[model samples]
Target chain A: MVIVVATMPIWLPATNFLTLTDGVLAGIYTLLGLSLVLLIGYTGQLALTVNVTYGLGAYTTAILTVDDKLNPWLTILIGVAINVAFALVLALPLLRLQGHFLAVATLGVALIGFTVFQAAPITGGPNGIDGVTPLSIGSLQISSDTAFAYLAWIVALLALIGCRNLISGRLGRAMQAIKGSEAAASSVGIRPFRVKMMVFVLAAVLSSVAGSLYATYTGFVSPDAFSVSFTITILVMVVVGGLRSVWGVPFGVFAILALNAALQTYGPSLIPAGGTDIPIVGYGVVLIVFLMFLPGGLASAAQRLWRSATGSGGPRRSMPEIGGAVSEESS
Target chain B: MTFLFAGLTVGAINALTGLGLLIVYNVTGVINFAQGDFVMLGAMAAILFAGANGHRAGLPLIVAVVLAVMCVSALGGILERTVLHPRRKSGPVLLLIMTVGISLVLEGVVLVITSSQSYGLRNFTPGPALSVFGGTVSLQSLWVFGVTGAALVALYLFFSRTRVGKAFRACEINPLAASLVGIRPSRYWTYAFALAAGLSALAGAVIAPVTTATYDMGLALTLSGFVAWVLGGLVSPVGVVVGGVGLGVAQGMVNGYLPLGLVAYANAFPFVILIAVLVVRPNGIIRSLAERRV
Candidate 1:
């Protein structure tokens, strides 16, 4: 799959499928999805503010690059820093709330973030920032859709590897333990609040990176680009993609993106009005319907298929995980 | 004075929306994100039946209002049965996400129906605005307050006096025990959702004139309602009423005080108070009389 994605620019000219832009987005979305899974699936945060973090990242990149003339690469670090600060401020109040309370508070913060993005002068208000500095490594400017796709995937892959390690490491276990039972986790000497805060910050940073990359690729950042609905869409994508395998996220991202693309391509023609909003209903329904059939998400279904395919599995993975996240999470 | 009246008016509507969330949560432990969508539907439905919003139904105002409420309530019941109840066994997180789906579907359908046009509903009783405390309150504001008060009174009576309402409380206490007592919790679940929907719809019908009905209004109202519910401590009716009113008043103050340059952010004012409350009093300002679910 990596090879196919890596070599896609070579063979893609021969085919009629125009997914090069979606490829870039899917890569970025994979990072966003992974970050979400780390927060909700693994860390038990159930956050609805991923969009804000992503938007903050994009805005940070946009502001720094456009106003300060800072290198786009530098803005990635700046974006991460901003997201951490934002997350820290939000998590301080949020840590006190749990379940629906946490979710609602985060949703509120996200709304506030959206308002700020739309109204604040720094963010260019509702118009957003245009003429964003494109990402480049030295003189080798990362221009063209194909190079951008590679840049996104490489970052996504690196983030995926980092998250995979985090999931298996001591801190990751601590996060999982907290998710299961904070009381039990703390009894074993884990500070639940501290761990939860760390995970939240980490997720924010990841979202920020994805958002920054997205801004650079698009060469624009606006309040219109970041919305609560997009946050929900990301949540749906991660959930419907499946929660069991961190590796399955990209596949889920692509599938959901494809579903969206198909809807966009055909929705307006079939429907009389509201073509732009049709994809959301389709995805929302897909999330609900997918949960009905595959509660663990498509990754779980994939694991099942792999199990039936492999036949001999004792502590062995049903499928290959992206960046070597295989076996441990499997049954 | 205007701020106070505005707060009271929107406060009443927020209270209704919060009640919708509260009732459904009490019965089913699910936060219906679609509650605001129901309110939007009710307002739109009322407009449609009243021959407003380019609709030619031309029904009488009273009949149109009744039909709107009834239709929305029925739709709520149908939604609970088909979309929510089937997924009752799933985790709360999944169910919450499902309500989001329901909301999106509703909003999408409405957007398609209205082509994204905003529609105004004629005031229930056309009258001169009342001057009180050096400010004039629209008649619709009176209707909002009146309907809310009557709804609360009716709810109090229903819960205290009606068999089904008691059974709903019973179901809230213990679904297993309620089922054992031949009080079908499933059936009551439908009723609770329908009741919540009816309450929200009624709020929409009254405030339709003040705010107008739009396809996208439901999502923001849902958050405001949730904030009101959370401020009231998620479990208690009294808490939500107070919380809703408090939030509304707070919002009124923010809108009153904030500079015109910053007024665009006033939509986030209630949430600010909500988060502050969550930080200071995590259990909510109005703690339950008895121990409740955290």
Candidate 2:
């Protein structure tokens, strides 16, 4: 499946379906969605700052390459480091908050990032920093849309593998334990805070990587791309695709981006003038419907159908226990 | 002195919004992320009913404001009944995300309806600025402070003096116990949602003249209100009011003294203060109810 997706740019256009650019976007969304899966699905932490971290990476690469004359590739590492450091700083205070409190706090962090992006002269303000230098190794440049699509998918695949490996290990168990019950996990020597912090940083790092790739591919970095709405869009993808499944990340990402792309192409004609907002309404409806009817998302729904077909009986593991109610649980 | 007045006005708005959040949170155990959107709805609806930009057949300002409040309250009630009430058993995270979805939908609907144009309400009272302590303050600002104070007093009386208020408090204290006592938690939850929406609309209508109304304003207001709630420790109503005022003043100071380039970052001051408070006093300046458990 990964190979087929990676090679989609070569054949997708033959059927006039999706393009290399669409593939690039899907790859970016996959990275972003997987990051959310790490925190929301595995650690049971609700964060709205993924886009802020993504912006950090994009801006880091954009500023370093444009203003400091640094290599694009080197800027990626620096961006990731900065994002991890920022995440650590943020998580130290934020991890103490539970449930909706944490979500709102993260939203505050994202808003602050946005304000800085728009205000700081170094960030180029709302005009944004364009003419971003693309990634190059020696004389070989990954500037073309096709090449960038391949590059993004390759990185995305690597991230998926890394996430899967992380989730299957002792660290993953610690995350699950913390998600299940922090006090119980602590009693068993799981160090919930440390584990949660690690997962938070890992998610931030992934987001930063995706952000850097996005800037490199588009040759532009704008604050608009990292707004709170963008964070919500990524969230919609993660929840719609399925929260716990690594394989579902691509599907979710593709589903949302394809819908958005389709909407952009056909929405205006269908909705008439000044009704471009119909797609946004569609996104909200999709999110609400999915949460209400399919809490575990499409992946879980698929699993349930498969189980029924195979003559499996007993209770299904459709809904994972909600993790953000730690405070209520303690009470 | 100017900063003080500015801060007071902003703080009053924040406090009102925060109180709305606390009211719903206390009863439902769910944070309505749509709280700020209620403010937006109130302001926008008022603008539409009152009409703007040479549009005639506009209702009187008071009537428009009342109708807007009622409309937004109905929205809150409908949202509670249709979307949230059924999922009362879900976790806080899911509920919070659902509110976010609702907010998105509201924003989109408002954007479509208003065509994304901003609207301003006529000030409740038309008067000249009064000079005090080397600062000139508008009569509208005075009205804002007065209205906020009155609302707080009314809310206090409602909670402490009324049976329904006591029932609401009971629901917050322990839903199970409240249910056992024949107090239906769902009824209070619905009331809380409506009350919260009405309160937020009041704030929105009051502040609309100063801040103007836009479809996108809710998210920012919500964040600011949340910061104020955190700063107050999410406990005492008075504490949140103070927190909101302090935050507003601090932002005003930052705007006044900070360099032009840094002025944009003033919006982030509430967040920074929130983080600092969380680190130093995780429970806030006033101890939270959860902390009082001991």
Candidate 3:
């Protein structure tokens, strides 16, 4: 609400590309954050592969749109297809590992993704792929910042609705059951493996959408943007925003962005060294503080404030378990 | 012949890393992902301490290494007892994220204090080449192998002969049962943390001379150790040692035999190995062997 009120004029101003870019980036985060919440928050899987999935999406779109000269609509579909296939291949065995082992394994995936994108010449290596043309609909073009922002938010909103529908349906209940106890869920006829794999593919596809939008917005894709640290940052957002709630995703992303902007704009002069690198330090501090104290995430905190102001509790969602609660015998 | 010795030298370092990882994993049921960062801290501390005292030549290198390990071990004990143990019931995902957060803070703090430039540890070995069998090797490489071997033997003895070590293993296998037997679970965690940190310190002290120390070196080391642990099997010291040696030899051979373009892909070895093992042997080599025992 404050964002709309504060940036009302910038949306239409000719020199407002920077503000438009920020809004589009926030929109992309919404998609990434929502996808992460679906797997991590809803299904209780601690996946560290969001950024890798995002990179895959971007790379897929880049190759199809630029190298192959595919249609914009076709490129998006191809991107989703690639991510889904990757997820299926990864999910079959990757889902068996639990706890820190799973986290480390996923971290390895992210690192490998970075290495492949950085080392492989076909993917443009370190310099990254450039000249990615924006999506066009006849006369309408998505090259400008304002158009990109609106398009990104539209896709993000649709994804949010799709997630809401899934969570509010039978599949949602199955996922929740799986989250609470895989053995019990299986006993009750819910195939825990199928549910996990479904969620993995779903999350990967959503992340791919965001990645494609991000590629269109930037007109470039680099390995640097999809490093392991990017994965950590996205996890921090989900954690800070409250993992279970649907609305918490955007709240987390904007909070992180606001923090980033604040540090970038104001932190340099405050430091004796007088440099722009303190934002990295700030992001690190924010993550530590949030994890140490606000374990339920920023979403829960936001709900608390809303309830206090309105003199009633807002709709509350049960805090999802962070990982699998049921231990399975590897028989 | 030197390639063989290089394999052993790198293998010894990997073994030390795995030893640290096994200690923490056994006690806490949580892998300390920040283990490599601790190793980085150890090496950085030694370099700084050396810088402050290296001019005098009065402080012996052995004493400096001991002090560095002591300080880092203390830090480890404090972190485990206070920050980590307080939220033990939160499960492993949060613990993993928290450790990652801690790693970020440590890396940043290291950068803030010392800058991001890599440093070299002063080598004390005799410069002359030593001959063995039909081959010649650097004296320093032989020392790395010897020290790592002694450390492993000591660890073996400690676990087999000491009351605390037995209690620690008991705690690992069944925490509630061990607590009933009057072993405080928290104390075991402290011992694990201290021991893990000490192992990291020794790894840093030994390898920094060869690899050069940097703030970010810990992540790479951690990845190598992680690959070795997963390959050999987590929580098995002998498996870790053997895995470390095997991995080092594999890496050495790749470096020696692979073409120029593939050599640039050498750093990808650990990750490729990790993905393959996770996909093919999620239970790890030792666990699979043990599973077949039944």
| lDDT string, candidate 2, A1-331, tens digits | 7669666877767746567787888888899899898898878789889889999999999999999889999999999999999999888889988766788778878888888888888889999999999998789998888888888888888998998888888998898788778999999999998999999999999999999999999999888999889999999898888877676788888777777767777877886654667667778877888777777777776777777798876564333432122223221
Judge candidate 3 against the unseen true structure and give its global Cα lDDT, from 0 to 1. 0.77
Q: On a 0 to 1 TM-score scale, where does candidate 3 land against the true structure?
A: 0.90
All candidates' chain B TM-scores are 0.95, 0.94, 0.92
**Lowest lDDT block of 10, candidate 1 chain A:** A322-331
Candidate 3, B21-40: lDDT as tens digits:
87888787677878998889
lDDT of 3 at A256: 82
Report the lDDT tens digits of candidate 1 across residue range B1-294.
Answer: 889899988888888899899889888878898999999999999998897744464788889989999999999999899888876776676677788888888887888778888999888888999999899899889888988999999998898898888888999889999999899988888999999999899988888989999998998888888878878887888778878887888788888999989898887777787778778877677766524431
The CAPRI classification for model 1 reads as: acceptable
Q: Which parts of model 2 are misplaced by more than 4 Å?
A: A14-18, A318-331, B286-294
> Which is the winner by lDDT between candidate 2 and candidate 3?
2
- What fnat does each of the candidate structures reach? 0.48, 0.51, 0.34
Off by over 4 Å in 3: A1-19, A308-331, B52-59, B126-136, B287-294
Model 1, A196: alpha-carbon shift in Å?
1.3
- What TM-score would candidate 2 get against the native? 0.94
